[model samples]
Target: MATQQTSAAGDAHGGTDTSPERWVVGVDGSPGARAALVWALAAAARAGARLELVSTYPADFYWTDPYLLDTVRLDEIRADTAGLVRAALAEARRDPALAAVPGAAEVPTDVVVGGGAAAAQLVEQAQGAQRLVVGSRGRSGVRSTLLGSVALHCVAHAPCPVVVVHPGAVQPPPRVVVGIDDTDVSREALREAAEEARRLGAELEVVAACPLEVVWSNIYSVVAPPAEETRARARERAEIVVAEVLGADAPVRLRVEDGEPAEALPRVAAGAVLLVVGSRSRSRIAGMLLGSVALHCVVHAPCPVMVVHPQPARAAGRPAADPAAAAAR
Candidate 1:
């Protein structure tokens, strides 16, 4: 079982029938985790949401000694992890960015330490959370992979949207970029993006990618349409989609680019504070959680990436099984 210690900076904001929204953050004392903590603090403060800081150690650490269950060793590991979470919280309180957001330094917070895989613990803790924030990579991350295993897993299985922040990412202008298509998931992403922009006091940019390619068939070789004409039609379709989802008078900047979605989204989102993408439900292949485009953006986007998963109904059931339990089995 995981142990948790809670601390609050102050009382919850007055006047609310329900409990305050919570934003869960995964911390591991890495530079990447620190970046994530900073972003989460600023966001939580802006939204008046509580922040939960979580850290975990491998439960299998005691497996070498099968005959003896060392409770003392387990307690020491938990204490160390708890201390790390507290240290990260302290540092986040002093971050310049958090200070910039009024009252962000005073957001209420809780610290949770678990004995299990980091991703699983995070996913479990993020239940009913407004968002789950994590570092793009952690200390154990391989240099070659842009995203670490834990971040990817959380993005895949967490019950809420997952925001992955890169360490030392350059702060961009106040703008939220969201990639959209005709899919229902994209519509959800657009709505969430609009809300995020409103909360952050940033402009909203809606982008659609339209790739043009020749059709080669056994019976006929169809040449690709003119670039200008193709672009114009793509723009028209994108405009209609945006209008339908966000109404005709929605205040948003729309852009249609000619390229694959995976490529165009990240390129267009460059220098943006946040890049939002929608992920489809798990695929037929086991352990495959996100679509190619969403996965690509999460791995390559210049700024923090927020991946919104399909709703429960659309997912055909609840979120995927607890990653920690699965790993244990």
Candidate 2:
């Protein structure tokens, strides 16, 4: 029983350090964990943060297993856990992309044998981490039991900025796709997207997905212009929002489309690394009946998505996003 320590440690690429700056990934025997290992190694190589690969399981079951009194059962569990960890590590090494990472050879791996709940353990490890990377699915849970339970839990409550990587989430020559609208939520999304694009050294793309309103005014149609003009106006409005959130100097490429928010984002992110969207602004009654667009994107987007809560109007004078507060931690 290794005691849990508050102090953090790094991996051996340059000799593990005790700084709280390491990049962490949670690995269980799931497809998502395997993807997370690859993602973590690549990120560690890029960010120069040591990789911390950890696998956690319930320890109570092991200690209380009366059947474990049979030496066979005890040994079997030990062997199974060790094999799972070893396999995960080996799978990571075999990935051409991850194995090719500059620091992949030096990334140290560790196995944590204990259990409260896997999601809780992973979230605990995420605290103080530079970033928390996890695959989209894991062991089952109570409500979202049908989806990737572990990823779902961590996204809702992890202390750090959590990135849930789905298998096909990574895009090439990446672009940052941001959903925009009239509200401050879209403003926050724009700001976050710009920052991420800078981090990944990619281009920022600002997009607005809206439904066209039709009005039957004969005189208005005779003098009014095409829908393209309306779209242009919407685009200009989005540009103002983008500028407000990202500042005049923020690098951005503009795009406007007419479609459902959910459909538009996936299409725009086809070759992008990430999609940033604002949490849906739903009335209490509406939210209970149907989930918002942001929630849907988290579950189904072709790429990783970051959902930001828009600051209240009263907070307009405050900083764009406080790094510490922006992260749930």
Candidate 3:
């Protein structure tokens, strides 16, 4: 049985309470979702956490299909979907990597079918789960613009940390990379990333994309340039940020580069088990339009990315600071 524990309230978005024994994953038969299923099974085995394969048929999937009026056919489709989910579990059982992990065979698997949006269902189940994993479409700039909608929503709203995996990601005991800045949000991002690294017995790499010197600023045409010592001090400050915010003793390698965050992050992300960053909070007006960097990474990294936001500190309390407020400075 999946271990029973009280989950954080944010768990309404698939964030579940995690201990040594409880883990849950949302799955569908999509290649990406199947990959997530396998990943979850392997993680469950290694951590001795219970696993659940949640498959949802969102109302939208049927919006364009009129055959649903045929009850018999609808029933058949549901049965077929259930079979596919079962097959995925069986495949996980046969995987060599899963078998090699200690106590994997003892891991329990569950299949749940829900009627709602995929993001909503997944997040609901995430309550009480240690972490949530999903597969990505592997799209990037220009050619495919935005992240897959489901992934975007899940990352933005998940109650617990979410892992959006890519095909053929490296197995566990891997390095974790987090994009850090001087903001409190980055501190929260670093803390979460460090905790994950510790749990996985992985190394942690902290990276920051420092702004280049304002050589061409219209108002600074006559201003003196920063000294080498000034730049060095900024880098040191970044390292100190990581050291102070983590609140735990863990070795970290810090890197500071000059470039845009969107560009710099991928360079660090290459070949890492996970890349974590904080979500840019949006204003009520802007929110009507789109999210920021955190939303973008949800769909497109070489590896899984965990987008951390400062969860409201109290249950049912207003957020302590504006997500935009954190980003402005």
Candidate 4:
């Protein structure tokens, strides 16, 4: 039995009292999910949030014919699924990776069974959660998460911020690395980084990548200005935007690298607790999904990556950001 007390919510996405302070984690008996569960335990502990471990089985992975749908077989699968959840939770309790989080053993947890595909079920559960954490790859392990369909789907569609934990990730470092840009999304990223830093009692470092503008493939004039000057401007922009979004009093380290964001971000994330970045938008349109940089981090960063979603226009409180001023050109 899962030590975490649970009650069937009936509805696929239902919960008795869904709270914003909840961190939802998708668990399977896979090595990746177990690693994700361990990371989420510490993260929720840091954020002072409730932890919910949800295990899902293919609700339709049964017979279609009424006569062929053996009730006993279905019952056995449910029982086995429940036991897997229990064992995963138990192992997480004993994981030394959570030692950084005091009272790790005492963090109240809720175990749930979702009846649907793993990605859809987890996304449904994340609707009311403060954040969603998932493993980059699952049990099959044949494909790198860079191309993992389920991880990609959740990254592009989950309602809340999604933290993708690489199975090979080590314990989170004491610093948070955020990719800085001049856009509204980047400002939002800085804000999230600030909050995460405070929550984890860690230092925050801002990194901006400024690639030299290229005129034409046939022209090799380096766009007039040298790359160093662009990098310098990148440093200045990071300082200004971070101060504006996080307040002048915020203490954040800034690094301006002379490369594209896709290259710079993962370089800085080598040993960081979390890599933070913002997606362009989450429209259903194919081209409007995760930005190139954000996707790269999600797929390759050795540490866990946190992709901050843009708040809706009517989300309240914060005034509209001037994209011209906030975004990098």
Candidate 5:
């Protein structure tokens, strides 16, 4: 079994009852990880949710063979991981944004250290969490345009919505942006984005992109529709989606762009506080693969990206996996 430790910060509401809504964050002592911790802290404070900080080390390092185990090495790794989480929590608590929120400094927190693949450990910790936050990249990250393996895995497998925060993402104006299309997942994304915007008291912007190049042909010289007509039709479709999801009188600003969705979304959401996108997958197997637009926004967006998955139906009598057992592997 995996060694574990837990701690709680002072109560935020002057009570002992822990909030049922929990937000789990992965900490790896990297700048990106620290950014994610800070974002999660602020979000938890706003929502009055309990916060859990998790860190992990590779179990393979301390497992010499099927029968032999390096107990001393495993202990050292656990201790180091615990220390890293503690430091991150302390630093995040001191953030001005978190402190700005009422009682944010006193938000309850827990720390967990496990041994296994970092992504699996995080997914295990976030089993019942309201949201899972991870950095777009970690210590092993190389290019800025690429997401780290752990973040990608968590986004694909976490049971709840996943928020990926880039290390250099700045605090933008109070606005939430969401990309939408004719798909059902996009409607879910719009709803999630509207709710988030309401929670943050931010303006909501619904964006739809139409790639006109798809209408053009190379061999037959097919004449594409006029740009204005194409844009008008695109706007109409977006408006219909917005009206269906959020009513006709919903307070949302809609934008129709004449370009690829992957490129237009990030450009339009340049300074927004959060960019909401939906995963175009229905089952767990398909969930492992993100749509091209969603994957692009997560990697290239200038603000925190929230990838909302359609809630899956719960399986009756399904047993939950043991995190400790998973860590021990």
Candidate 6:
């Protein structure tokens, strides 16, 4: 295993020194990884953020017995990884897309061996990064991993927000879509989506979903109230989110439908530049890494999905999202 120190070394592209604002992207030479790289480059240009292209492998490549290297030489792996990063950099330079950006010239890029499993390395390396971008699918062994699993891990655990870029997604329309509930995390998502919309000179659409029925499980189940009642309740909840959580001055369009966020959100997000959702929030179905709705959008949204972490504690413990805490903040 290469020492953690060497693993993090950005020596492949000179030294570890990087741009003030950096966005990390895992580059595994897959079509998905390349797409994410392209997106990250354009986004960096827009946000004045630099790019960090990374590829990782098990530590056994260097630390374990020579026989365990699996016929793959460390030097060879390093060269290939560097070459991928270089190609991404070249793409950034040659693409006409970034030519008009004002500060594009200043954003520097670095390629490094993240040194570990794809998800863990990205989450660790992205600690101080502005954002981490990954493609929804990937197909390289050792140095590359499909984002299906890796994207889930990073969105839930990365210190900063995570963006899952879908391959061949049409250029998003002038709008941003967000799913919000009467929860801090959802409110956080709302703000992020709104800000993104504003920055892109697009409309901001806020949606809330309400389940028509309540599942009491194996015990005695109680039927839900009428649709009118549910709609009223959902509307009231959205009002509170807009008033208390979002404040009156925030520019947005609030719409409340059924609380089935997964079903409700993707439809609203259609043709949007981005879909923003909380990793964890107050909802009927929830889990540790990602709430059902967030996961759904990450996998099936029409455009890129930005999973926002509301607070630090839940993410730190990396526990199932707390429903009660939704009101805490």
In candidate 3, what are the lDDT values of residues 21-40, reduced to their tens digit? 55556666666776676667
| Candidate 1 off by > 4 Å | 8-19, 66-68, 146-148, 168-172, 214-223, 284-291, 312-329
User: What's the candidate order when arranged by decreasing lDDT?
Assistant: 1, 5, 4, 6, 2, 3
Per-residue lDDT tens digits of candidate 5, residues 14-63? 43546868888889988889889888877776677888888887777454
lDDT of 6 by residue, 57-152 (tens): 666445557664654566666666677667666665555655765555445577767456887788778877768999887674322222337777
Model 2 agreement with the true structure over 194-256: per-residue lDDT tens digits: 656665667678888865656697777767667788788888888788667666555568888
**Best TM-score among the predictions, by candidate number:** 1
- State in Å the error of residue 198, model 2: 2.8
Instruction: Evaluate residue 303 in candidate 5 and report its C-alpha lDDT on the 0 to 100 scale.
Output: 88
Which stretches of candidate 5 lie above 4 Å from their native place?
1-5, 9-17, 65-73, 144-148, 168-172, 214-223, 282-291, 312-329
Which should have the higher lDDT, number 2 or number 5? 5
Task: Compute each candidate's TM-score over C-alphas.
Answer: 0.85, 0.71, 0.73, 0.84, 0.84, 0.75
Model 4 C-alpha lDDT per residue in residues 192-311, reported as the tens digit of each score: 777777777667888988887767664566447676777787788888887777666566778887678988898888878888989875865434444578888887788888888786
Q: After TM-score superposition, what is the CA distance of residue 190 in candidate 5 from its true location, in Å? A: 1.1
Assess each prediction's global lDDT (C-alpha) against the native: 0.77, 0.64, 0.62, 0.73, 0.76, 0.68
Better of 1 and 4 by lDDT: 1
Winner of 2 and 4 under TM-score? 4
Candidate 1 CA-lDDT value: 0.77
Against the correct fold, how does model 4 do in TM-score? 0.84
| RMSD to the hidden true structure, all candidates | 7.9, 6.6, 8.4, 6.2, 8.1, 7.6
Residue 294, model 1: Cα distance from true site in angstroms: 0.9
